[model samples]
Target: MGNEHLIGYARVSTQGQNLEQQRERMLALGCTRIFEEKISGAKRDRPELLRLLDHLREGDVVAVIRLDRLARSTSDLLQIAELLRAKGAGLRSEAEPWADTTSPAGRLILTVFAGIADFERSLISERTSSGRSAAKARGVKFGPKPVLTPSQIAHASVLVNWSRTLN
Candidate 1:
C-alpha cells in the first residue's frame, strides 16, 4: 500500500441525498481524488463507479466511507474486489475496518460480509416471490390499468372507420 494514492468513492441513493459527509471523510483520510456519485448502491450501472474502476492504477487504493456505499450485496462486493485484484489495486472502507484489502484480516472480513449479504438478498427475493404468488392467487391484476374502457375503444374504432371511408 506504500506510495499508492488513495482514490475515494462517495455515493448517495438519490439526488435529494447529500454526499458532503462521505466526501469530507474520504478527503480527510488523504484521498488524492474522489468520485462522488448520486445513485443507489443496488444499481449496477453507476457511471462514476465505472470511471473510478477505469481510472485505477496498478498500485492505487479505492477508499469508501462505508462498505455499503461501495456495494449493496456480498456478491457485488466480491465482484468489485476481484476487479480491483485483477487491476493490481485494492479497496478500503473507513467505517468497516475489516474491509481493507491491504491486509489479510481485512480480506477475510470482507469474505464473511459477502456471504451474509448474499443470504440476506436471497431471503428478500424469496419473500417477494411468495407475496407476488399470493397476490396472483387472489386474482390481483398487475401492470398498467387500461387508459380507455372497451366501449371507448369501440367508439374510437367507429370514428376511425367513418373518417377512413370519407377519405
Candidate 2:
C-alpha cells in the first residue's frame, strides 16, 4: 500500500488468556509490525498501546482483532483515533468493519462517537457541579466528618495518660 506500514496490536485480558488468535489474524491481514501484550482492559497504563500509538507515522495503519482490545472506553477510543488522525494514520478492526478509519463512513461514525463522548462528559460534569452546589447550600459537610472533635480528642488523650500512670 504505497510504502505504508500496517502495524498490529494484540492484547489479552489476563495472563491465562492467549494472544495466538489475534496475532494470527493481524499477520494474515498483512501487518508488517505488531505489538502484543497481556493486560486488563480496565487498566489505563498499557505500555504497548502507548508505544504503538507513538510509533505510528504518516501513511501508517493500526490494526486490532477487535475493538474492545484497543481501548477501555469510548473516550479512550476517540482519543486514540484523534491521535492517529493527527499523525495521518488510520485504524482498522478486523471484527468491526465500521471502525475502519480509511473509509468516509467509518470516519463519520468515529466522529459521532467522539462527539457523544464529549457530550456525556459535559453532562456528568454539570450534574456533579449541581449536586455539589446543592449540598453546600444545605450546609452539608464534605469528606469524612472529623473522627473526633478537638475537645473529644483532648479528653481521650487525657484518659489514656491517666490510665498509663496507674499502670
Candidate 3:
C-alpha cells in the first residue's frame, strides 16, 4: 500500500446466503473498506457494485475472493477491468493469482483472454443472425401483435367521420 486503499466487495445471490466468510477473508487481506450485497451476478443494476466503482481512487485496488464473485461472464469482467484501468485503479482476485491487474504479466494474460472472448462473442452473434434470417425466410413473425383489428379500425374511422359531419 502506501496511500492507496485496498477495497473489498462481497456478494451472495440470495437472502439465505451468508457473507460472513467473504467478509472475514477480506478482513484478513487487510482491506480498508468493504461493500457487501446479496444480489445475482447476472443482474446489471447492482447498487453496491456501482457505489464501489464510483468510490474508486487512482492507485487503489479492488480485492475480491474470486473473479466469479465479481463477474458472471468474460465480457463483464473485461468491462470492469477496462473501467479500473481508465480510473488508474486495479483488480485482484485472491483465488486466481493470474488475475492481479497490478502486475505486467497479469495485464498481458487478461488482454489475451479478452481477445479470445471477443472472438467467441462475434462467432455466436453470427450464428444467431443466420438462424434468425432462416426463421424469417420460413414466415416466422417477430414483435408484438397489433392492438386493433382491421374491422375495429374501420368502425372507429366511420365514427370519427360521422362525428365530423355532425360538427
Candidate with best lDDT: 3
Worst 10 residues of 2 by lDDT: 1-10
What's the CA RMSD of model 1 in angstroms?
A: 5.4
Candidate 2 residue-wise lDDT, 36-78, digit = tens: 9999989989999989988998989899889999988888899
Top-down lDDT ranking: 3, 2, 1
Q: What is the C-alpha lDDT of each candidate?
A: 0.90, 0.91, 0.93
The TM-score, computed over Cα atoms with residue i paired to residue i, of candidate 2 is: 0.83
In order of listing, the candidates' clash counts read: 1, 0, 0
lDDT of 3 by residue, 1-167 (tens): 44558999999999999999999999999899999999999999989999999999999999999998899899899999999999999999999989999989899989999999999999999999999999999999889988999999999999999999999
Comparing 1 with 3 on lDDT, the higher-scoring candidate is 3
Q: Write the per-residue lDDT of candidate 1 for residues 22-121, one digit (tens) a residue.
A: 9888888999999999998878899999999999999899999888998887787898998998999989888887789888998788778778878988
What TM-score fits each model?
0.66, 0.83, 0.81
Model 2 off-target regions past 4 Å? Answer: 1-3, 152-167
